[model samples]
Target: MATLVATPRSRALGFGLRHAREARGLGVRELARLAQVVAQDVSSWESGLRVPKLEQLGVLFGALRVAPPERARLVELARNAREPNWLERSMPGISPALSTYVEYERTATEMVNWEPLLVPGLLQAPGYAEAIMRAHRLPPRMVEREVAIRLRRREVLTRHDPLVLKLFLGEEALRRSIADPAAMAEQLRLLVRAAQPRTSSIRVVPANVGYHPGQAGHFVIFDFAHLPSVVHIEHLRGSAHLYDGDHVAAFRAAAETLSDLALSEQESLALIQGVITGLE
Candidate 1:
């Protein structure tokens, strides 16, 4: 049988559906029988060669006894297998690309981030985040909303089975003050506290590191267990999600280079501490 090329959304749905079914010890034939579909159809769905209709997805998940949150996520994925979920309709001014990026962040098991100008959103403290948003000239309401979103994003750091985050931050990110001296100091201290090696690692690339792939701009690599990895690049207008294997590999290599150029975790923490002390 010719294999169907799988896009990110279809791949996610297929993997989730297949995982749920296998966890219940059901083979493809068994699941097909239970869901009243042909064996080839079930195989196609599981392989991401075809996306199941919403009603069919309901039948499959029901047979597998998939539970609440996960079942809802699977349904969402099935409904939008060909395109990103339309979050902008619900979230008034939110960029469609950003909405999709948020979904990717939620589902990703691991994330590698390279930030050249400021702290990554997942690590920015509330005060600093607010300050940065305001500096971007966002409307007062939008600034507040964006800051709230940043804080909410940070929740992933503390969630049960939190994401494995590897962050490469430019040294100037530490010295750059987004808010008042006190707020910057607090933000630096928060960075020190959150730099736990098990769940999160923060590394700073010194200013003197003359040239690197990261000099191109900020990007994030989202890694999944079942679906293909993707790289997200953000710009002033919108963002780009790169799924092509070569592009993904190049970004992965860049991440490794940045990691190597960055200071050790302990050294990075000490440098942050020194910056905080200077602020005091």
Candidate 2:
């Protein structure tokens, strides 16, 4: 039986609520007072920790003065927040926040990834991903499930209208080999093949580049045509989705810095090819 995981719709709605409130220069307490709800409730809503009831949602939206179209969208999200789907069945160990990130990935028109450790999940080969999961001590069953989901995630790369992928990898990512040399070689070859300019742009930040923003960690920025951009930061325990304008802007600036410091597309491919040759 497939375990049911909560959808990220509430998180999306919370993001919309927080954006609407801040745009109106209203604090959580102030909005709570206007909406006749506790301040903690407002905080929980914005954090995506809780979903507001319909009545509370109505009052909160009214207090924030959300515009009609966006308000309608938020309402729809609140209404359908818990609908089940195949993602839950496929990605068994994925957290609610990650599920939300997956949804963002599915809908995003452009994705910017900064990976300092292993290869980014979307681009990971199944064997490489399995090696990674095992290294993390995941049970064999869970590792197989995760590898399957990771492979499914790669579909985004081949979709008819594929999302533009701007991938930045740290030098260490290439230097660090997974347990199996053959699998690592396959992964490197895959990376080189997927770095086409038209669909995906891949760059490598040299180890000698000295301290830079990417050293901070792995993160991804998803940009949508009609929705506000979001920054996702993953950690050992869980992940965080940053929706505030300033926070998102700061991450964007960091992405730009990393991009500027990374090796050119041709250079990165050459570096990857060199690694593959060494394995051969």
Candidate 3:
């Protein structure tokens, strides 16, 4: 059996497999017995330590009675499980990209996020997130889904073995009002509270900071304890998760540069509060 590298696609594929098995109430040995595979191999496939043969994946899906849409998605992920990078576009009903992102984010040890346009999702208030999504002209159902996801994502900060966050917010992001002043102010207040925890750090990078690494665009580096680091770049249309060593290193360097360009933590909180005062 060929072992699959712990790339983002493999991780996502593993998550899909585990979810399918759990949904069907099949334990590893039970699923393996039905699929005619070794229970240990099944564990490896579900942990992203190995890639299941396409035939084996099919058998497992048949055993689990996976739905057509989800079965197709898992098969696609298995096919691309060895890929070093995964680029995903938004899809109707639910976005595969978003689901993959959430899967990786949940297990990440630390996240260094640089945003030049808006607050990081984990730091965003429901009202603020809803406003931004509404401004994007998303379908109302999708907007509600995204808002709910955003709110749920914030719990990662307080969950056991919580995700450590390093956020660099752009000055213009604070200036660009969304929804209404009152809502924006509430959002800023939320940021202030989010910055208080030791596990989270919020810093503001002033606009026109002259040539900074963040000028390129926004990205996040998610460092994991046992898996390779993944660099995620998001845009208006889609998002890409990068696992190549060079790419991850570049994002790490960019995170360092952003740290240098950003205001001190205390100063950042002051600026956030100042923005909140202005809005009020």
What lDDT does each candidate get? 0.80, 0.78, 0.86
Q: Any residue pairs clashing in model 3, and if so which?
A: none
Residues 48-135, model 3: lDDT tens digits: 7788888988898899888999888888888888788888877876577887788778889998899998888877888888998888
TM-score of 2: 0.70
Query: Highest TM-score among the candidates is held by which one?
Result: 3
Tell me the lDDT of candidate 1.
Answer: 0.80
Model 2: residues with Cα > 4 Å off, grouped in runs: 1-52, 55-92
Tens digit of lDDT per residue, candidate 2, span 145-247? Answer: 8888877877887899898999999888987977488998999998988887998999999999889888888888888775557677876666666665677
Tens digits of lDDT, candidate 1, 55-75: 998898789998987788778
How well does candidate 3 match the true structure in TM-score terms?
0.94
Ranking by lDDT: 3, 1, 2
Off by over 4 Å in 1: 1-92
